[model samples]
Target: MTGHHLAVGAVLRRGKDILLISDPPDWALPGGSVEPGEPLLTKVTQETGFTSVLPERLLWVARYPAAGVEYEMLGFEVTGVGPHDGSGSWVPLPEAVDRLGRMWFAPIRDPAVAYLTGRARVATLWTWTDLNEAPVTHPHVAPA
Candidate 1:
């Protein structure tokens, strides 16, 4: 809970397939640490190699403590770009969900996926004091 690591990730969709890094039985979104003052979308593009303009929306924010550090993940929804030289495969949503469920990081969960697929409302934001603890969800409200 002392150290803070902030990262950004994106779910790039094309037709019925979503872009994902091939991690054997698991998969990962295109993202990495937010370098000093680096834009999240830029980081995503650098990781995924998608250069065309796409609609990007902030979808979720997750906070969890792991390996004696606090980790914050920002997830986004975006339209897919043309093929790139990245190391990943485009898979259908169902397959993407299965792989994300098995990822080493805390599962991105179905609700988040649903949001990305435009099948559900934006998910409640979540925070956890420890990786092994249950997350606390907060509803979003606009300021008056």
Candidate 2:
């Protein structure tokens, strides 16, 4: 019951498969904390044994259906996995979600994924719609 937001993460893999931290009935990504001066994405990769540079962070979803706390989760596309990592499995998006609470794999159906599909922030990575906005500040990378 400490201040926390429902964060989620994904380790995007080949064949469009993903590494999921699953449960049952609801799947979630690998993420936590929204502290100011922290590089959220790097922390996920470092802690989870994934690559330091995630492919992308696709969403910033906010959920505050509680009291005295605010949670802002940033969802990302993790790239590679290291050997001896605890879990490295291919989980389809749908199955990852359906198995939520039953297991703790990477999440495949975090609602934030749907919410950020058309966001300009993510589009910058895929479509490169706004290169002018490059060097635009980042939590880890300063605008240069």
lDDT of each prediction vs. the true structure?
0.67, 0.44
lDDT of 1 by residue, 36-122 (tens): 677657767776777742646677788777788877787888765777766468889888876776676563553355455454445
Best by lDDT: 1
Model 2: per-residue Cα lDDT at residue 83: 48
lDDT of 1 at 60: 77
For candidate 2, give the lDDT of residue 32. Answer: 56
lDDT of 2: 0.44
Provide the lDDT at 124 for model 2: 24
Report the lDDT tens digits of candidate 2 across residue range 1-144.
366554545445557455554334444455555456566565566445654555555643333323554444445665664642654455675564344434422122223343223212442211111323222222222211
TM-score versus the correct structure, for each prediction: 0.76, 0.51
Error of 2 at 117 (Å): 10
Candidate whose TM-score is highest: 1
